[model samples]
Target: MKNILLFIALTLSVHTPLKGFELQHIVEPSASMISLQTQNLCHSLYEQKGHLVCLPWSNPIVDTGKISLLAIAKTNEKGLGIYQRARDKDLNQSFLEEVFRNENFQDISGFAEARALYKNTVFSIIPLHFAAGFKLNNPSLPEVHFIEQRQTQIKLSTTWFLDNPLTEEWMSYFIAPSIYHFDRASSSGDYDVLDSATTPYKDLVQNRSLKGANADLALGWSSKILWLPSVTVHGYRLFKESSDCSTCLPTYISLDSLNAPKADASVSWTIDHSFGSSVFGAVIQGKRLFKSIDQDQSAFAYIYKISRLQSYASLSQNQRSFGFLFDANLYQLGIQYSNEIQATALQPKRINQSYAYTALVL
Candidate 1:
């Protein structure tokens, strides 16, 4: 009778309307139990489930302009380990930089993140992130260039889960909305040439205030034969004041107004098998920028379009609490490949640059 009642309560919670103050505490424990079961299947699965539950609260859409700190090290061809490089150039050339030269890549970077979860009438979570780094290099110029970077972000979200009769799986759905502020400042010193001529350096400074609205749907099957899939759609808009650039040249050309909205979509799939402990799995995910317009008069408008596709794959082993992932570019039909450098002064070519990341659950 308790199980039946629990099931009935779960069904009602899934269909409940979203209200500013509508808190439902009755279904919290059952959702937590399901989360625990998913965790037992594998650490990656656990992390994925946790992310799905917190997606709405964490604000995945806002561009905090944060880059991965661990990416400073370059992965070898074998994808085994990382080696020390002269400077972390890739860190400075992120997609975010397309909007502004806000970050300075450093040989050593630091980042810290914290999260909190609560259960009441609804599931709520908060996540905080901070990062700092620096970069110094001589790009065949007479003077040395120095860059320092810092970023911080915080988000609040609420989510709900239910059983799907058609797929015979648990469906986790969420609506996440968030706001964030980010800033990047760069400075360089003048250099003296052999003939005692001085070359001037210009400092670039920029900051943006942005808001995002996102929704996600995730399906977790009870049977091993089924695959887990999740889809997310997000939209972002910049504040009017944040669009003004005082020093550095605009990173991207805008059409009509800089406040135009940007749309993004992501899809992910995972499959679990018997291996380490009770859980092991592989995941493939892809993300694309669906909507954004550039002014034809802008120098980059001809070469750089807002359309982009990035895909990733990973293998998980829960017993060791360690996993690795690979990131690459995917070619799309009807999409023209342009020189990224000519379009955005970023990359020389649209090469399928590949990188690997290691996941360690602490």
Candidate 2:
């Protein structure tokens, strides 16, 4: 009689609004013994179940006239050890679900950042900007905390814009110099470690402190045509550095492999119509554009602004994000949501994150 009652309850739970609270059970009745088994799978099936969030931050470019100021704060948390493996294997949603079923999911790793920037125009043709930011990443879970990093950055830049009379377009060039500091600490244990003897520069994988200066450069072209988009190419680490400090980053990493110079391009189309402004573009960052799509951090983005309301969406490698912004004369408020793929040594895990930010025009 008890076994029959339990089966009836299970049927109701699966069909009701509490269907997600699925329960599976087995009941055996024998002459001398009764056996019962039960399990609740709701928590295992949901993502972001145990994550702790504190309003992260993200933003879109806002023209704040001659002088502009912006500030941002954000935090991201995720259950580690999801896709901590090589990408060579074929993976599907069902496979990921099965793997997650066996995981003791917990918020074991994440990062937080605080940033601010100031910008102004010089002689109505040169743009000058200053920015500084700090980021911290400390994971408490030993199973996933293979590396912890803290970073500090400060940058100053100036841009020169010149108009082309023949082409009726504008060409701009910018150079930014920055001072950066970082401390990386790695676990001595074998768990979740990416460093191996076979891997190049394995020695640099352990605990280290580095601080140095580098510069970035950008060249851009803009036209008045609706279909002819603006194009910008950015180069990081465009200039070498000289650091005498003991903890300064070695030239090998800065000039050679790890932090070698990198370049990427962005193309954006802007149309100002009766409704407002619509901008859409793509940023591609990789050595190979089409050959290895998965290895690139390329992204397609679109933004629509009708007066004080702005909406944006972006889709990129293993991530999708969308957000909305409201501009109120002096201050702007915005919020965003992102579903990202966090790469790890054991496998690649999917993480859901959110961000909120506000900016002020000074």
Candidate 3:
């Protein structure tokens, strides 16, 4: 009887505890790549009104305006995984706000996300998960500008395990589908300064009161065919008809609706190898955006139409990880490139972006 009990205990200990508790933190900062003239234009617009009327010309300027910090904690015990993440963004100090502030910007914008997953549930047929997240932004501009965003998502995923006949090694295929609801609201401010000619500005602000549904599909395959490589593909689409724009600004000629169906697809390939206590890996990815049905040439669709390619390599020593990444167009590698703009020279001459990140995992 004692021997039997000892055998059962050893089996349980070997099968459980796949992933231990982990805590991580990340910081990302972006700077505007636009020219000085574009910065001046954004500043002038903000000065004319209480807030910037629209998304920036290059959009990269807007992207550069914010700094983000994130903290995450996760644990997987007995096949039940739980994770929580919190992110904070310095919206006022961002390149966007710096152009207007002329000094350091200082408003806090951030979000919190939590997710729960039950693996091998339902007779080991699928994994069930749910996630919830929210973000808020409070700008320091006059008249009080505030924005709040919320999302809820549910997913069902499954994996198929196989054995390679030639290598006699294990392989896996994974697939997941998710549905989510996203909503955002922007508090109405004193728009008295914006006149008829600046009607687009009003529309931009009021359009923040949007609600819609979206769906995501993801699939992945892993094998040791070529040095233990894996490939993953993900796609998402938004339902335009379900989007509500009732709170948008009123216009006599009925401006083109900015709420349009949008979709994006991306694929990534990665390979990893380990030597002693150190590991090395490389990843390549490509993303493409589909043109929206709303042919309003004045909208942001033009910017979203550009595709991007990304490549990165990483080295990790136990709990420490570091990586360098580059993103750009595959065809244009030089400095005189110009494919991101619609009409003006607002886009940067070179579309390349370089970034690096380091993480300490505990």
Candidate 4:
């Protein structure tokens, strides 16, 4: 997770014309694992055996989760060091799986050398909530309403399409108006102790991203179907680090019609040489999504997160264990964790890796 602050540039809400007091918002949630395993952790996360998620698989420490899938990594690289030529225009399934999951699979000569080149490692997402009245001029709707209540009915206008052609350049903006959260798990199964409500803190986050989109068909949610063949962007911002303080601008493309519905799920993924982009990143991002039971809003879910490390350069570069990450909450609480792996080289070079964090959003 990098500098995710200041992306809120309020350009005066241009009301489209509304009649009802209905609201609309969007949300996206994402989670993944990045590592340098040499086919070690790979087989463990992918392989399914005897009704148990075992070898060839990386199972969640906790068996139960609301999320649909869990990604795991191996070489953090694309194209085989064991196969194919240097051309990365077309990577295979193995490559896509490894980088997407991004679980630590490889061990270097020492920590000192590993930390020197590593740049980023993190698992996160960005959520947006728009409390606006849609259908501009609706007879039953209010001119303006709290979008907070519209999250539950949020839905996509169409099944997202791919093959639309991807993009390259990322936008230029500071912290964007968004929601974010994450958890760092110890060897233990517990994810966090925070309440999902308290986890994101508020509408802003630090060194986070608003969205990240990828076009590698192999990693697609409807991998065989939807193809949003365009360059996706992941941006974020921190509105408040203090309990109650002044906010700042957020990062984004500033597209007037780019906003979407509040999504209960935020899909994310990546592709190696197969999906060419000297730098590849994307997010199935949305603005917000809340839940309710018996007409009573039970919970509102949103998150904002960003992370860029210098590891796996061209598929293999400076690797660092120091990064940011989070997970889905359970029972009554949420979870969070951060990592910082550094290197100090003397005649006796040493790699100082420190992993410390707290659990709970209360």
- The best candidate by TM-score is 2
RMSD of 3: 22.4
Model 2: lowest-lDDT 10 consecutive positions: 30-39
- Tens digit of lDDT per residue, candidate 3, span 1-362? 47954753453334222121111111101011111111111100110012112111111112112222212111122112111111234333454343333311111121222223233211111111111111112234322222222222222222333444654452355454545544444332224233334666655344344455555454544443334434334343434444355544442111111122222221222222241111122211111223321111111110101123122122111111112212232111211111111111111121211212211111
lDDT top scorer: 2
Which residue ranges in model 4 land beyond 4 Å of their true spot?
1-31, 34-230, 243-362
Compose the digit string of candidate 1's lDDT tens values, residues 1-362. Answer: 47954753454334322111111011110112111112112112223432222121221222222222111111122111112222343333333333123222222222333323343112222122222222222333332222223333343333344445664444444444434333323222223232124322222323333333332223233232234434444443322334334554432211211123433332333333242212222221111122222111111000111223211122122111122223222211111111111122221222211222221111
TM of each candidate vs. truth: 0.37, 0.53, 0.35, 0.19
- For model 4, how does the per-residue alpha-carbon lDDT over 1-362 read when each residue is reduced to its tens digit? 12321211121122222221121111112112322221011111111111111111112222322222222211112113312422644556565344223421111110100001111111122122222111111223212111111111111111122233332121111111223332211010111223224455233222222322221111122221122221212222212122211343322111111132222211222222332211122222223221111111111111222221112111111122223334324211111121211111100111222222212211
- Candidate 2: list runs displaced more than 4 Å: 1-69, 77-145, 169-205, 239-260, 287-295, 343-347
Tens-digit lDDT track of model 2 for 172-224: 23232333333322221122223344455445334444566555555655435
Alpha-carbon deviation at 249 in model 1, angstroms: 3.4
The 0-to-1 C-alpha lDDT of every candidate, in the order given, reads 0.26, 0.37, 0.25, 0.20
What is the lDDT ranking, best to worst?
2, 1, 3, 4
Record all residue pairs in model 3 with backbone atoms less than 3 Å apart, i.e. clashing. Answer: 65-94, 65-95, 65-96
Error of 4 at 131 (Å): 33
